[model samples]
Each structure stands twice: as structure tokens, then as C-alpha cells.
Target: MTQSTPSAQRRSNLKHRAILDAAAQAVAQQGYAAVTIEGVAALAGVGKQTIYRWWSSKAALLVEVYSDLVSRQALTPRSNGSLEQRLTGLLSALFRLYRSSSAGAILTGLIGEASRDEQVRAVLAEGLVVGRADIVTALVQAADASLNAQAVNEVVIAVVWQRLVLQPDSLDEAFAQHLAALALAAGRLS
Candidate 1:
């Protein structure tokens, strides 16, 4: 069997990253509905087949886009600080990521699509929501071994969802700190 050469692999990786980055930019600027395979291909300077070879549909492409963004941006628990401090940091980072950039627009677009598409919802929930929840759960447990990780995760996600979907204007550093305090208090009660 023949293997892909190192140069070939590098080129492939570059192309893949280019497409994802272009898609993100497109979504950020024009929104999901405005993005297309041909548009992304043109933006990435590739053939339409290149995108189709990797993704079956625009929604699938968007799932990958959000997945990549989430993997890069999601914060984890830090052992160097108290749980409240670390949690607050995580929340603040999330708020900033979602507030100040195209990441929020990408997420909002994907979320709106997820409402009508089961596959999109699954991918978004697994790759974005559950992944972040897992990180928060660990932080909650680290903060207090006796805390209910599941409940804490639920509360954390609820607050984030409220800010992301229901009330985007509510996200801020102060809110993050307050949310962390509430989570900590809830953990103690549980």
C-alpha cells in the first residue's frame, strides 16, 4: 500500500484549515444562510469538489467549523486557583469569546439551524455543549468533591444558554463571577 508523502499531507492539512477558516469568516460576515460551497471554494481558492470531498452538506461543513472553533476556544479548569476563581475565568473567557468576535455569530447561526435539523443538533450538542459541560463538571468536582457534577453542569449550561440564545446582552465579567458564585453555592447545597 502506498502512503501519502509528507509534503502531500502538509498540503492537505493546509487546504483543510483554509477551508475551515474561510467558512468561519464567511459565516461571521454574511451569516450561515449566505455561505455556500461555491462561495467557500472561491474564498479558499479551491474547487467545489474539495469541499464536497470533505463534507456532505453546508450544515455538515458548519458543524465541523463550530467544532474546530469550540476545540480551540473552550477553557478548562486550572489547578492553580480556587474553584471559584478558575470557574469565573472559564466563564469570562467564554463570554468574551462569544461576545467580541465571529465565534458568537457562528454559534448563533449553527444553533438556529440545529432547531430544524436533528443531525445538526446532535453534532452541536455533542461537540459544543457536552464538551464544555464535561470541562465544567471536572471543575465543579475539583472545587468540591461532594458537589453534584451533573447538577452543576446543568446550571452552568442553563446560564450559558440563556446568555447565548435568550439574552446575549447579559454576558459580561460580572455576570460570570456571579454565576460562578451561584454554582458554588448550589454545589454546597447539593
Candidate 2:
């Protein structure tokens, strides 16, 4: 493999971050229906070919955008808290994130698009479901070694997704606490 010069690498990294940010902004402002590769290219001040050179499709770009956004912006659960507290902290962070950031719109768009697009659905299944589930599963195992990780993860995902998609209005600290308590109780039983 050819090595990239430090300057060239920096430039490429800047461009990549710009494209992801632009894609996120496009989705947030225009909704997923209107987020075209062309639109993202224009917003990022890059050529359409530049985007295509890096990502195979808009769905692929969106997956990267979601991952980058979550890594950079999503809140981390406290390491010191009780299992209930840690889970509550994590869910609350997610709720606050979805409520306050472009991530919310992007998530809604992904979910909506998944209904009709197999590519988007696959991306969601891998990125959102598995990614979020892994985090919760680890937290559940930490909380109670006897608890069923997969089952608890499913419950956590279900509760969060319901708040995100079905009842966004109810995504609050109280809801986060309730969801955490419910998950902990059910997890301990199983």
C-alpha cells in the first residue's frame, strides 16, 4: 500500500469529517427523503464524485455519519454508578442526545427509510441495533452477572426505540429512570 503524506492524510481526514457533518446536517434539516449525495456534496463544498469515491451509497454514508456522530457526541455511562444508575445514566444520555441533537432526525430518517430500503435496513440492523445492544448487554452483565444479557439488551433497545420513535414526547429523565428500573428488575429475574 502507498503511504499518504502527513499533510495529505490530514486533508483527507478533514474532507471525510466535513462530508459526514454535511450529511448529518442535510438529514437533520431536510429529512432523509431529501438527503441526496448531491446535496451532501454541495453542502460539504466537495464534488459529487468525491463523495462517491469514499462511499458506495447515501445509505453507506449515513451509517458513517451516525457512527461518527455517536462517537463524538453521545454521552458515556458513568463507570462508578450502580447498575441501575449506570443504565439510567446511559438511557438518559441517549434521550437527551436524541432530544437535543440532529441525531434524532437522522435516526427517524434511518428507521423510516429502512421500511422500504433493504440497504438502509441492513445498515440499521448492524449499526443501530447491534451497536446499541452491545453497550447495554455489557452494562447489564456488569450490573448482574446472572441476568440474561441478550434478553436485557432487547428490553433496553425496545424501551429506547419506543421512546425515540413512538413517544418522543415522553423521553425524559423520569422515563429514563423508569426504563432503567424496569430493565434491571426484568434482567435480575432472568
Most lDDT-accurate candidate: 2
Off by over 4 Å in 2: none
lDDT of 2 by residue, 49-87 (tens): 999999988877887787777777656678987888888
- Tell me, by TM-score, which candidate is best: 2
For model 1, residues 13-39, the per-residue Cα lDDT tens digits are: 999999999998898888777888999
Q: Which residue ranges in model 1 land beyond 4 Å of their true spot?
A: 188-190
Candidate 2, residue 156: the lDDT equals 81
For candidate 1, the TM-score is 0.87
Model 2 weakest 10-residue run by lDDT: 67-76
lDDT of each: 0.81, 0.82
Report the Cα lDDT for residue 82, model 1.
Answer: 82
Assess the local accuracy of residue 147 in candidate 2 as a C-alpha lDDT between 0 and 100.
85
